[model samples]
Target: MSADEKGDFISNNHQVQPIQNSLLPIQHNPNDALPSSSNPRRNPRNMQGLLKFLLETTKNEDGTHDSEFSPMDEERKEFLMNVFESMSVNIAEKLTESLKVISQAVNITQQDDPSDCENALEVLTDLVDEVDVANDFMKIGGLQACKPCLYSPHNGIRWRAAQLVGECAQNNPLFQHNAVQLTFLDDLIKLVDTDTDERVRVKALYAISTIMRGNEKAINFFHDIDACHTLMRALQSDSDRLKIKVAFLLSTAFSGDQFLKIQLQKMGFITLLVQLIMEALEGKKITSLEHLLGALISLSKDLPDALEDCRQPNLNFLNILDNIIQTYKDDSACLETVSYASSIKQMVYSYTDVINADR
Candidate 1:
């Protein structure tokens, strides 16, 4: 009786213990932090989250140090320098990852929903304005990705792309060179040539101005492609800004090679410029007038065959000067006017010597 009872009781206890273990709920810790893979706070799991975090850090109220995104703030440089340094090691990879997200959001085909495009472009603009990031931006296909946006049916996207592309080419030689190689220059020429939007045209022209600075090869390329003609036509527009930019572009091209100056003169650029100067003086748009004056002075300073060109019987630069003088005879007290007068007089006197010598 004792042996049978003991065996039965031991087997029943073992079976009961197994059932109890299977029935109990799995033990877990409520306070344990989740893995970064599962937690958005530990790591941003999506583009919106990352963008929000970045935007928050750029605000002064974020309590980090200072705002980095405010263009007018003094702390922007320090903040940008710090971020630039931190990302310097793998900036291209890091930026590429972020831009991939931004690209989708800012795609031109995003229909009428532009909230993402606006925010992303603002971020990109701030980043590129931080100095050397523009080169890195190009390295990461940022410019290529946005190229189509330049012609977005929506003006906002086109304008944003225009601004971003201009900044991408800002004072960055490599970026500018890349632009030329990648046919961005051709795109820019098209924008300036036929885009109906004046704002976009001006921005593209500004980018062309930046890209062509001290770049003789690019200037020559533009000249070879007949882009000079497009620029010259742009000068005919009534928008003073566009005219100033076109004049500036001509001045830059003239500054590049002597042949460019001769070519421009042959194309009647000098005649058109003189007419523009007279119009500027009459319109009283002081800034436009000054820029036009600067362009003429820039051309005069750089044109290798200035005296030779002035000697052309058909040019009549002295007559043009006389017309300007007759137009501004009473403006003796205006320093700018007087300065222009003196400059034109010097040109006439110099050209007169050349003419007399030819005789």
Candidate 2:
């Protein structure tokens, strides 16, 4: 056909009517000739080709692509969603197997060349983050599927695994209760204090934080195992990122009880925290300063007495508060410090009223 004729056929003069008619169920004539394979009852290859074309057109190198009217993509997404919706033992077992395969791939890649190890770790990390995969894995045994990866030679894999474990430990109480092995906590503590990889250390700190918050028994175990000191040592690390995470974890611990806050205060954590906050403010690292401000707020709420004690004859608490209020008067973060100062002022006023009343 000529180009113009082809265009006309495609646009308006096509034989779509015949095709639609053929798609309708046919009533076979009893006395007619039998159908031949040339015109087979149904052509599987055509259907397969159509499906392949739809899939390829709607997918990119990275993954599935968004489409406006792609039925195949929609069906595939729905199928995967349904598979994830069914939470059963069988599904958990299958996810465990998938994680094992990814773990093996990570190890093999790390051994072949350290350079490619990061790609493998990224793949493993993505796999662990799959909601069905993570949910099922946690159901089967939290951290069990990922436990082997913790010892992988590549720190990236170990770090990602620690983060996944932390997420699981935080959200699933059963996993938290069942998975409290001394070796696990000790390994996490070691990573927090001594891991050469900064990301690994951060992940380890988060995992420790999750464990601390998951169960009261875990908290007691951490203190009994002397993990708190390890966490404290992390605060002294040169990395500000590490310091921030350490501060956050310690803050959570403080919010749990007065005794924990007092314990941290006794360990001289407040001094380090105040210094960190001051340094962040002076350096004009606004994000770090904001985090430090939050930590300070928590400390102030939990250990007001300890903050009060920081006020010496030469360095008064009220004077420091006044300085901070003036320095950050326009900043939204300064509001936290302002609120704290206002609370302190109200308390003092109340005490003075009581004293006057007694007089």
TM per model?
A: 0.63, 0.61
Summarize candidate 1's per-residue lDDT along 1-359 as a digit string, tens digits: 24543353334232211111111111333443322435533322333434454675444465666644545466545644553343333434435554664566434564567656656665666667644667556645676677776767766667677788778777777666667766777888888889888988898888787777766656767657388788888989877889988877765645657677777777766667666776776676656765676576656654545534544566555655565566556765455654765675575456657467457
- Best candidate, TM-score: 1
Question: Model 2 scores what on Cα lDDT?
Answer: 0.57
lDDT of 1 at 107: 49
Q: Please report the TM-score between candidate 2 and the true structure.
A: 0.61
Instruction: Supply every candidate's count of residue pairs whose N, Cα or C atoms clash at under 3 angstroms.
Output: 0, 0
> Which tens-of-lDDT digit does each residue in 1-359 have in candidate 2?
25643343235322211111111112333343222335422211233333443564445545365545535578556644443333212333334455545445335545455434444344434444434444345444335546666767778677877887776566545446545643567778778877789999999888877767737766665555266687667767778888778777655754675566667667766666666655665676655655555665566564666565454333333444455667777878667655654554343334654355346
Which portions of model 1 miss their true places by more than 4 Å? 1-98, 105-107, 302-341, 351-359
Candidate topping lDDT:
1
Whole-model lDDT per candidate? 0.63, 0.57
Query: Worst 10-residue stretch by lDDT in candidate 1?
Result: 16-25
